[model samples]
Target: MITKEALERVRGWFAGRLPEDWRAAPADITVDREEITVRLTIPDVDLPADTAEAEADEARAGRAKAFREETREQRMKIAQEAQHRYERKVSWGVSVGGREELWTHVSAPVMTRLRQPQRLVLDTLVEAGVARSRSEALAWCVRLVGQHEDEWLGELREAMGHVADVRRKGPAA
Candidate 1:
């Protein structure tokens, strides 16, 4: 978590310094690797600003992107300068969707409707000392399948990607 003071400082930095594009240049502050990352989120300048309507009840979504390849030179320079001035590591970034969804370890209740046979299988695992409970057994079984059929799963994911691409292109005439 970024400190409130640090967050405010970044806001103040943009408000005071950055030329010509302050209000429009939205930003975020995060603490990572013991450094204060001052990310200046530049909007899609590619979008037609002079569009007729406000594009109400809709958001302008670019590609599901991660770690943008390009950014305004000035923003980066200013961030680096701030890093030097504050004697703290300050980094800048301009991304479309920003960060990727990296998974974190989680232990949460999950609701599932298993077939009677599948439920019996889970109970069998517990009885055989393979798992502590039905849920644990089910999870263990999934992991076993995932480990054995990694490549097959990868191919299935690739197929899903193609399906998504086709869907995005819309139905044929």
Candidate 2:
């Protein structure tokens, strides 16, 4: 987990550096032990499809091709800037938006083997109307914890780092 001070610094940096048009889109900023990541919600733009439209004439097709190429080039530069400025170890996640479904109960997937009792608890959230599905219930639980117990979470993460350091030392030290 990132320290609160680091998070604040990164947020300020992003606020100052990002262009106004890009800033209009929302971002999910997270700090793990190794890197700070930002998942930005791209603005809804008329993105070009890979397949050419049958209705488009030659001139229209040429113009659309040029426009799409320009957009792609601009996006690459933005990503390069973010990678250079923000992350220390890994790259930040950036994309042109099409993740409207993620806003709902169906969010990103995490693959983990949970005990049967834990699965039942997640199911209970669905039955109690707290979430839409097992996945949603799990996400809801995580978000609830993050909102309410950030400091504890941060301390726990720091402790885990200590544990890792100890484990790396091996026995008979």
Candidate 3:
């Protein structure tokens, strides 16, 4: 499990390395065991007041795409350095005009053994066409749980963080 202090260090490192002009504010960094995701919010594109909603959206998407292309090399370099230092894959994303796009993110396969009941639930989702396969169904279920129980999960994570801190302060084994 990643400690709060380690997460903060990752955030601080990105904050120092990222160019000020690249993001309107500091990057939003999230780290898990396998990867670190860095999301930067760029300045909104300027459009005519009379621009149609669809046109405005297209413009925003274009801006995001252009930024992605323009900064590809720099982003790659930074990601390489971060991956080496953190020993995890690095994913990049950009948010522009209320839209967010993630590119080059890792999709790691997870292995688990499910009991009959759990397997049935996943099969039901596949039969209903909610997901294409057992893996997809399981992922869908996990995402649903995350969305619905976000607050509870957040509190649980905080408690776990506190526990980790206490353990760290205890004598070494």
Candidate 4:
């Protein structure tokens, strides 16, 4: 958990540095569980103080409007860049099998590329007892299953069929 003083220091820094025309670039502080998080948005630069500033106020208004639009675009680009960095850093682990069995552990940039609904389906299957557990299901889905999940389920179904066959045939028989 970050201290209140720490958060204030950060807010103060941004408030002092950001441009006047930003309108609002205040830091938002929130506490989640034991952690304190701060979200900060950069301020847009004020319009230039050239002769254009002394001309009709409408011209200044137009420049300010253009600046705000440009700032918004820059903010979005920055957000995307930050998101890509976060996605690269965050570790989402998927482990297969139990103790003494072959367990493949996957992580990082590999995890986020996974299709959302397909991942959810595997999670649901694990909850429904089709797969063993959450981690097991995720690992099986990611590593063994290819991009085409329907085809992968068909393969799993065939493997399950063979297991049932072996069970019915018996080693002694």
Candidate 5:
């Protein structure tokens, strides 16, 4: 859970820095700055209702079994498959819009002077629909930090330079 103040500062940074085009997309985007977490809801897959409860309960009482022996193996297999799938899908990039949304979720401390560039990247990703929201983009960013680290760092550096220019130019004089 990010502190309230940290969240406010990051939002302030966005409010002060984000470009109009990027901000124009619906502002309903939410960010949690402390945990460096962003949350977006996607439609969840519906699970089938269990219909064998009664029979299973009777069998459980007679057998005194507390767990499914077969389920353990199945769970391991599913876990491995999911991990493989995640690795394969990790390359998917977020839209710029989503990247902006992600920047909104990051803390002001970590983003520092490069907040806007980070925001831009995230926003671009979101607009492209590579990620569903800021949080997802951040997650993906963190996951691929090793590969995309230089690009991200470059964006941060660029943002810092822009901020410096803004400060020096004094807001359009």
Candidate 6:
């Protein structure tokens, strides 16, 4: 887990490094052990309010793609510098109007040990065609839990941060 101060520093660095015109608002930064994801809210395209939903979506996607292509070189340069400084891969994404698109990002592999019961659960998911393999099954399970228990998870994370703060204030070993 990243310390609160460290995460703040990471956010501050990106806030300072990013071009002011690239985002309509401050970037949303998420940092983890493996990577940092920066999501910017870009300007929306102008269109008639009566436009069809499909057409509106298409326009938003086109805008996102154009932004990605236009800023690719500069984004790569920033990502390289950030990755070198932070020792973590950096990913980029943009939200235009109501549509969000993520560019190429790292998908790190995770290794885990599970008992027979856990293995059986993953196998069941694979058999049901919910996932292609145990790894996918595990990821699906995690996503489900995250979606269903987001509030609880958020509270738990907050508690964990408090614990970290308390630990830091304790006497030196």
Candidate 6 per-residue lDDT, tens place, 48-157, comes to 99999999999999999999999999999999999999999999999999898887778889999999999999999999999999999999999999999999998998
Model 4: how far residue 79 lies from native, Å: 12
Better by lDDT, candidate 4 or 1? 1
Q: Give me the runs in candidate 4 sitting further than 4 Å from their true place.
A: 29-69, 72-122, 125-173
Clashes of each: 0, 0, 0, 0, 21, 0
> Per-residue lDDT of 19-46 in model 5, one digit per residue for the tens?
3432224223233322222222222222
Candidate 4 lDDT, 1-173, residue by residue in tens: 33344445544643564445443445443332222233433333344556463353555444444544565554445434433533321111111111011111123232445588867877798888978965667767666546567686657756765676666679775
Model 5 spans with C-alpha error above 4 angstroms: 1-114, 147-173
Task: Quantify how close model 1 is to the true structure by its C-alpha RMSD in Å.
Answer: 20.0
**Per-residue lDDT of 133 in model 5:** 76
Model 2: how far is 119 from its true place, Å?
1.6
Q: Answer with 4 or 5, whichever has the higher lDDT.
A: 4
Model 2 Cα lDDT, one tens digit per residue, 9-128:
776766666556543465666665555555555444454665354433443444434434554555456546655776553333434333221111112357878999999999999999
Ranking by lDDT: 3, 6, 2, 1, 4, 5
Judge candidate 6 at residue 5 and give its lDDT: 81
For candidate 1, write residues 1-173 as lDDT tens digits. Answer: 33344556766775577565432455555543345555544444344566543441122232213223333456568767876766556555444323222111124466999889989999999999999999899889989999999999868866765676666689677
Q: Please list the residue runs of candidate 3 whose C-alpha ends up more than 4 Å from where it truly belongs after superposition.
A: none
* Model 3 agreement with the true structure over 1-173: per-residue lDDT tens digits: 89999999999999999989999978999899999999999999998899999998988899999999999999999999999999999999999989889998889899999999999999999999999999999999999999999999999999999999999999999
TM-score of each: 0.39, 0.42, 0.93, 0.25, 0.23, 0.93
lDDT (C-alpha, whole model) for all candidates: 0.58, 0.59, 0.94, 0.45, 0.42, 0.94
